[model samples]
Target: MTSKIKGLKHIIYDLSRINEWWLISAGFVLFAFLPYTFMHHGRVLDIEMFRILFTDPAVYIALLIVFSAQIFLFASNDYFDRDVDALDPGKRVRNPVCDGRVTLAGVRALLIVTAIIPLIASLYFGLLAFLFSALAMFIFYYYTAPPLRFKNKVFLDVLSHGLFVNTFPYFFCLVALMDFTVGTVFLLFAIMMRSTMAQMLQEIRDYHIDSQVEKNTVVVLGQKRAIWVVFSVYIVLFTVTTCLMLSYELFGWGIPMYYSIILILAISYIPIFRKLLKAKDYNREIERLWMGQGRTNRWQVAQYFASFSIYFILVIFLIITGYS
Candidate 1:
């Protein structure tokens, strides 16, 4: 009985993956709040929505589904990458299953429990939300799982990552809660393009290690191509920013000084983009660039979401104060 209790404790902790859960939760909040901001921007933003959200069982349920999805994703990633991780000294020490702290059967049970809850909870949102949830879970599960593991397929790999990781989570939460429009689709497009760039950065970050492996299976597009792809996506993002400002009354920014803020963030990436494009020595430049950046590739993704969140909050404050 004591051993069973200990096993249960470990399973709970391992599956929580708390740091990643919180980070993704931040994205969820950012995405979920977008519709609220747009819908109430010119009008006095309601404090009542906050109260209702706090009291709403559905909000809690959605959060639980997201939490479960994170657990399933990261834990399953560890399980599927166990062999690869076991090859690395650091990862082998960190992975519970790989380190013998958890068994394969324990992992199987963890996967099943975590996977089922989201599908069940999503039903409360409606059949469309349920279908979206299923698709999200399927992509999450298969990204690293066997038989058409999408993680190893070059263009499809980053595309899938963008879809399941960024846009779908944002899309479903909005679909579950509010009426959406073309502006919403544009927001989703921006989110996806940024997500793909981040995943591309991850590919660049992991490329050296993956290439070092004796029998290489890395399908990340070569770093040179990825750099150009990121640049291309960067252009699309600028276009989206323009369209967003033109098409929507963002937070009652009738005169969108907010566009400047986005442009500031967008411009910061350009120095590196130009450097990578012009670099004469590819290998040395990439090593130096990745080493110098210091921030995680995913940091940029969170950064964008966070900026939008602040924009949302700022507008609400303005409206509440009659500044808008």
Candidate 2:
């Protein structure tokens, strides 16, 4: 009984690592289902509609598939970059592969096991979902796998991260609705830009290790260039969001909504802007971002919270004002 209890405890601990506090649970709900819910925008917001969205077995299956893909990609990335991660002082505790907690064999087993259910779910969801799922899987694999580790490439890295992690799965969820609108396209582009910016920030944090490893990320171009690119990406993302809001034709609510969201982002970004302006040594600023309790991380997290809240509020407003 004692040995069995220990074994069970170990299993539970391992599962926790894979679960990631069930953020995937929240992500699939907010990201996958929320966009799908947009299809029912003009419909009455009530318990029945909520039930239809939440209670569907297909929805759960799709969530499982997307979650599996995310885990597989992360595990594979850890497996492939274990050496670099081992050298990265910042990532040691969080990286099981680098610390020898999760072996290559274990990672491979994880990858194989998680790939099965998504395929089954894809078949059930229909051809379009299946195709999107398959494409996402391909990108996820190539993003970290040898010979084609797209993450090591310059522009390709950000593009792959944006599409595989954000766009494709989003489309997989939204495809079933088949309600493609100009607004949908704009929103998708906005999401891609957002994802790219976040990915770029990560690349900045990993710059030294990546440089040692000969990985050619955008940061390799130099700190000043990378910083400028980050600024540019955010500007484009803001523009896209503005365009999306205009498409909704809710100037009264949408205009305020746009300025509010932008203001939140700007407030968060101010600290980083201060740091940048005062930072004479580019490397020092990068180190502060990566190693110190700098404003960049705080701002990034704030932006994440603000973005989710703004979108959630927008959905609620639409339901309250426009729903029949």
lDDT of 2 by residue, 106-197 (tens): 67777787667677778877888777777788887888788998988888998888766645555666665464655455555655776777
What TM-score would every model get versus the actual structure?
0.75, 0.78
Best by TM-score: 2
- Model 2: residues with Cα > 4 Å off, grouped in runs: 1-25, 28-31, 34-42, 166-168, 247-324
lDDT of 1 at 192: 81
Query: Any idea how many clashes model 2 has?
Result: 0
Residue pairs with backbone atoms closer than 3 Å in model 1 (clashes): none
Worst 10 residues of 1 by lDDT: 212-221
Q: Report lDDT (CA) for all predictions.
A: 0.68, 0.63
Total clashing pairs for each candidate: 0, 0
Clashing pairs in 2: none
> After aligning candidate 2 to the native by TM-score, how far in Å is the CA of 58 from where it should be?
1.8
